[model samples]
Target: MNEILILSEDVANMVAAGEVVERPFNVVKELMENSADAGATRISVVVENGGVGMVRVTDNGRGILPDDLPAALQRFATSKIKNADDVYNVKTFGFRGEALAAISSVSDFSIRSCRKDYDGAEIRIKHGGTPSGVPAPAIEGTTVEVRSLFANVPARLKFFKSFSAEEREIAKFVRFFSVINPNIAIELSINGKNTYTATAGMDMTARAVQVTREKDLVYGESEYEGMKLSFVTSLATVQRYRKDMIIVGVNGRVVKDPSIVQAVVTAYHRMIPDGKFPACAVSLHVDPDKVDVNVHPAKTTVKLLDARDIFSFVHHNIKNRLDDAGHDQGVQMRTPDSTEHITSNSYSRPEPDTKYDHQFATQSYDIASEMEVVEYEHRSSAEIVHIPEQSGAESAVRVVGQLFNTVIVCEKDGEALFIDQHVAHERVLYEKFIREAAMTVPSVVMYEPLLINVGEDELAVAEDSKDVFDKFGYEIESFGGESLKVSRVPTDVLNRDIEAQVKGILADMLEERKDTSVDYRALVMSCKAAVKAGDKLEMHEMRRLVSDLFTTDNPYTCPHGRPIVFKQPEEFFLRKFGR
Candidate 1:
């Protein structure tokens, strides 16, 4: 055969399709992005069979003219980027024109759009880069329909997940966009059932209530130069859903810059329990050049020109707001009339379970139950005893230090260990409280039942633990359809934020249950009431920490599977000092 190599345009387009269409969700993402780019006020997405059977996105944005329908389907052709120079100052979400060309190559794709002056027109195209028919007149807005997403690529079909899983992914993506763009109405439906719908032009609190199902009462807001930062941190009673609610942005665009997330976390580092994440959202406005959005394909990640400055800005913004507002994070009370938006099917609570590790054989020892220990007016001064020590070849290497308030350092004979302080405390508390929670416990009053409205999703979790609550000295009852009332509280949580503590308990239940199968609710409550890091500790406190750490089942690590301690080898220290 003569050496001849000329690839067809269809082959090149198919190659490009791989990047634009990775999974069924990508189709919905692209179409939705296009709708937002077109200035659509309302967008709706309908999917069937995880979007493998059918995917359609409708937007009420400025539609394409009849003359532009054919050209819009062409590869590398775009109305988004007029010239190469315009790429740097680009602001729209869908600048890359590869979405349509790529979609058309993999499936039966069609677009129906109408410009302001002209009637809407529909253009249909089949696989292999050929138009099945010409554009025909249609409706007022734009709607794109895609069928058999990977029909032309059978190899890709093998990777599709279960319909429910795919639907979850789609739901998550849609929810994020809906939150990011609160002014634009978004509706999502799966298998002919409505999954999510958000109001157009809603305020930040309204949008937050829609997404998180918690209180949207603005705790505080502040202005810095040209930017304004506002937030409504969860009260102690609200069930926490994340370890850190570190949403960041420059001029309303959500970016995954580590500095931003880190700064926000740092702002509330002292306030939050080790593993619990606070709930808040912050929006910033800045010059585009100062923030680069071209970092990731999904646009979630970004590179800021002045990351340190941005970090400082966010920190100051949060601090100023909190200080000025005099917001009492320690208060366990909830604002009345706060609405919760969650469905029964949004998330469910798990049944009681227990998990035990068999890797290490147990050694019998005398220990008081947590409740018994707490009940004693004065802790007994028991003699300090050291356990059997490891010797010779079998001894494990260890290293240790403190990083952020929640991190502990440990290095074993040679390996490095970084421990999460919060998780470690969680593990320790888990071991202590699980036992206390099983017995009939007495009510220890810290405060009167602080009525707090919880999100429906979180309420499901709280309701699941009614029996556990009764056992742990907590007299909790449903206050109303949307709230929880506490007549009695955990004795250990005296002088603490009762509402935040309860929310932390719910969060702990959800997180640790998947791994340990233990009474995570009790564990969460223990951690919430425990002493946090960053509080200046005396020698006694540090000694107690070390001693308590060693007493645990796995002294080397914390509860969340992160190391609890790290040590630097003497030789390394000597080398550094030039001994």
Candidate 2:
């Protein structure tokens, strides 16, 4: 007998299932892709127990004929391509033809499809067995149902996450597809509870808003060298803590291209403050011949013929839009007594002023010196603070006086309380803005819209962030090549230099840093708008600040994690004076 023998078909299919059907999400993805390729206008996905118990997808598209039903479950059988040459130019989502075969080998699978020219047919395959096909009720589309996934493969079942976690993964993928395929009405149900539904006929922007839950997005379009790019991006002022909100699709297929994502982030460089990412939906259309979708088994990664050129193109276009929205780079603003203003070239000692005492000036000098003298070095992650919930005790605190015009002195229950003026004010303003943001804040329309001249790069950033400006009450529009017109301003900053404030907001949007929960735009605005160190406040203002600070949710720290209030016991005085 020969030493080597061909593997059994069932064993081979089971092996393929390891790659093609790694999880329930994969099954859903493949089925939905097939539906899309079939010209599905309406797709519905229903799952139970995170798809471990069941997964069903229905599509109203061109279905399979009874004659083709058996072949649809056979390995290497597909109508997507004829020969190896056609593989490079493949446009449909499913070309490998292994999805159904591999999926059926590990679970109970059935597909019911109806073609306009042929009688309806149904195919059933269980655990890699021979497929059984029969005539079924006449229908106009296809419905694929998978049950007891990984039932025959106990080892694979162990790798699955909890029901809720797995369901979240499925929901995430569905939302992504819904945004990219706006023309398709997508509905998802988990455990019979309708989770998500996007009605058909909505444009890409509208779909993005529905999926992302963000209303401050600006739409942009650009065509470059036979490629088209359509994107809806959040303003530098509107941001999320994580990069998960950024969605990118190539040729209508959602992908995980880090380079493309980085290009988009780079476009906002120096326009958004560091440690924040803008929420965006990017759709790229390229010639099928210029891209290869066979790079990964999952088909979620692709190879481009001119990746660098594409990256540059995306970067330029996105940057131009951001600039046209008045988010041009190179604008900086100063915060009173903030260490951010200290630089080696401009570092100098300040003369004492009557606004603050020597102690406050000394503290500011120390902070500035620490910032200026320290050499550049990477810092570790920030320390997490555990804040207890608020209670009635906070309301009893009373303001005493100001210390060095920086710290507010207060008295409560025989304890001396000291609050950092800047941090305290930041907390108050943060809460106030958050509350105002929940409502419809008023706006101030400019009598004459201000015209701003910008470079190509600036124009892109401005245009991309126009909607963001509008959301914040600044109505800005493109005024022809490299110029923007600002017709409205945020009521809060009407008295300030509108142009300078616009530039500052844009610059902050482009700056890069670590991820943070602090809204960089709001933080920057609050910091600028708040009363700073060395500003003398009347007794009533001090009392009002202390009163308002106590009313906030977290009175101890600002939005940026800086401590606001410090406490000292009366016993400390006894120890100091030896009473």
Candidate 3:
């Protein structure tokens, strides 16, 4: 018997469905693309139970003809293209014709359509079964309903996510589409509750505001080589933890083009802090012949003919706009306040005093003339308390003063010890937290919970590290949307910026996910909660910090492997003075 015979048609379609319809979001994407290609002005999408139970898409567009209803479900059948040559110049979104076939192969699918020349018709198919069409009432457009998705493939159904998570993915796709097609009204509902909707006829900026939920935006426009670019980017002040807020689309299709996104981010590198991402909605219109949309199975990844040129164009234009805005602000600053009439370049170099120069020239050169006499009130050597010769805890150390408000200068054993106050405090806190984690650390309940808006990547990291966070006395819960509410924080971080500390911890944890042995959570908490350099400390606080540092098991270095203390021997100073 032949072991590798061709699979049955039903089985073949089920296998192909895996690529196109990976999740509920893909279903929504393919259906919406079809609607857009049909010249849809208004589209509605309704899903129940995270699109596992049902997904219905209704579009008021030029629907399919009654004669073409059956072939719409046939494999490799599509009206978007006629031959192989047309594939190179494809413009429509549903050229592969596999979306509907693959979708119907895995789910119970039905399509109802009405064209101008024929009466409305309905087609029904069950899991790659033969299609059946019936005469129905004349509905102006098409409505595709899919029920019990992945019912035939139980293994795929098991991998479905929570309803809310799935709905969020669908919402993200809808928002991207809405931003790209501002003239098309789109509504999305989950379990009969309207979750997102965008009205038609909004201009680019207005539509971007509605889609990104950002109001402080700067608009940019540039055209080159038949490609037109329009983008609405968040001000440099507006930053997020992840790049998920940056949405890029090419020719009315939302794509995951990394080069374009990198261009925008590189432009803002000098303006924003590191590890921060600015929200942007960039729309690029290029001729369909110059780009290839058939690269990916989902058609969300495209290859541009002039990708490098596009990137350089976007980068320079955004950078120039930001520079112009900064220049205008500088001009405003020098516009002369009510009392001053000084321009930016108003200061001029003054002439030297002639009398002092002439006197210096006439006088004899003497070293004593450069020095000033001083009277000192010296203390007796007997009154000084000398440190012990032993290098143990028995020797006492006295804090002299702080240097540059960053390091603590202490006198010990006839030597000076320069301690990095920040690292000393960090080491102390790290050990303290390690001990507390073994036991139970007290959690301080906040009167008002801190709401942290995180991108999808950060949220995933947080969700994965929930138990670790709970162990460290951080009580975090998803508070709807892309936010997490923190009702309780570690007592060590009570007065600190709880949101920034938590997000920092999450970001570090994500970076260190592969290394399980590292205590990133504790390290992050300690670093964030510790007193930083340049912070003024009272005498008592300095004494207490020094005392705490000595008590730690490892007082010489911080948790991040930075030296906390540096000692200079008296012999070294004597050698410096040529003793």
Candidate 4:
């Protein structure tokens, strides 16, 4: 082995820059966050050449003290925290203090600030050189300007996409940040052209409307155990094709937590199309210690300590609000041209950024390829008259005949039972699979790994819920961006439409079995593994299916909430025939 050696400060700073500054947009993010942390009420960001030429962030917050100007460029020097404990109780958007050090090491950087007690001062650094300070013009706040980002390290420039892509990222961040921090006025300019301005004093709803470019939003608020969640979402009438519209922020920091995203998708399960998403601006506020913001250097992803509880909180509150909106919409439709029902009350629609299956995730999949999309005909309450079978009664049920080779016809006393063969099998398989689930359930390892294309958002959910999927014997691994490779699957669900089953699992089937884990995998697996509509069954198979169906706790409905068994009494035939 060769002798180990320590890297120089310049080399180390560049290495840290690799993590802290990925692109020009990252430089803008760090500088903008600094302005916010400085208590700036009015902030402006100007970018040129997609922020590769120059990025200037100006703020009217409390300027950096003259004495701390030089120290601010030192690595690990930050006023946000003083001790190790402060890391857990951070209130500021930036605390690591590596941004400036890492940024200045590879770019032409300058910071100018003036406090009320002292005269205005400015600090400038050129590619990690010795910092120079001088008495600058008087100002009440701070201004950080970065030019030729990564100029010293041309290798970093190679990783960036075109200027348009970089500019889009910067614009996306500004729009999301403005929506979350409505109290601050933020201005953005690209290539010297004014993009947009978010004026101060606007509430979150108005700001969201202006930034999101959506209209007629609904507002909702809910608090549970000191945690608070408020949202401005589009009505059920409004929808978009992409999942990019669902912007979520926590404690003033915009993040992309999959748990939170799943909750939002679950809330709008059947309200939107199976392939569309809604536009929503969700703001969640909890104590600082409750969330881990240091998961990544960018701080765009967070790990919630109480993810399950938080999921419930987000889902129930938004679902309840949407339910009320739906109710109000009904009243509005009855009154011709009268628009005071929900529009006057509160919202905008939310479409997920990576909406793949009209559920959660980033990319789209042709769900109709593997499985037939069931189009249940719309029927009124009067048209859908049927009796629900009592869940658990030991009355004997006998298999009479098979209807259309689909439904298993049965008889118990004076009532005729029409049981959907597919759904009945699903119920039976779901209960059995759930009970046998363990750390690594029985699975079928395929010779060739099945590849599935999904959105980033959908992949995120899959990656996050790895444990849940493992119980159902799914071995999913990232096959690069927006694709997943499955080497193993649950034994019963083998050879079935794994793609459709994955979509259903990530889509509407995240119903929690109890207080702990979500059982979405079992529901989807059972549905996929069950017999098809035209799969003819023998008398013995039908009898065994009917016997196994009634033994389940919920024999009347399938795991997907569809009716499994329907009942018709002999009295109905007598009434219709005038007997």
lDDT of 2 at 134: 71
| TM-score winner, 1 or 2 | 1
Give the lDDT of residue 31 in candidate 2.
95
After superposition, which runs of candidate 3 have C-alpha atoms over 4 Å from their true positions?
1-3, 327-527, 530-579
For candidate 2, which ten residues in a row score worst on lDDT?
Answer: 355-364
TM-score, each model?
A: 0.60, 0.59, 0.71, 0.59
- Which candidate leads the pack in lDDT? 3
What is the C-alpha lDDT profile of model 2 across 447-541, one tens digit per residue? 65778654333445566666556545667788984467877665556656666566566655544213366555566656655688987886656
Candidate 2 lDDT score at position 122 = 94
Clash pairs (backbone) in predicted model 3: none
Ten contiguous residues with the weakest lDDT in model 1? 341-350
What lDDT is reached at residue 71 by model 4? 90
Instruction: Give the CA lDDT, 0 to 100, for residue 152 in model 3.
Output: 89
Candidates 1 and 2, the one with greater lDDT: 2
Model 3 lDDT tens row, 260-348: 99999998876777888877888898888888888988787999888988899888877776554442221211111212212243322
lDDT of 1 by residue, 82-118 (tens): 9877666566765667788888888889988887778
Q: Candidate 4 overall Cα lDDT vs. reference? A: 0.75
TM-score of 2: 0.59
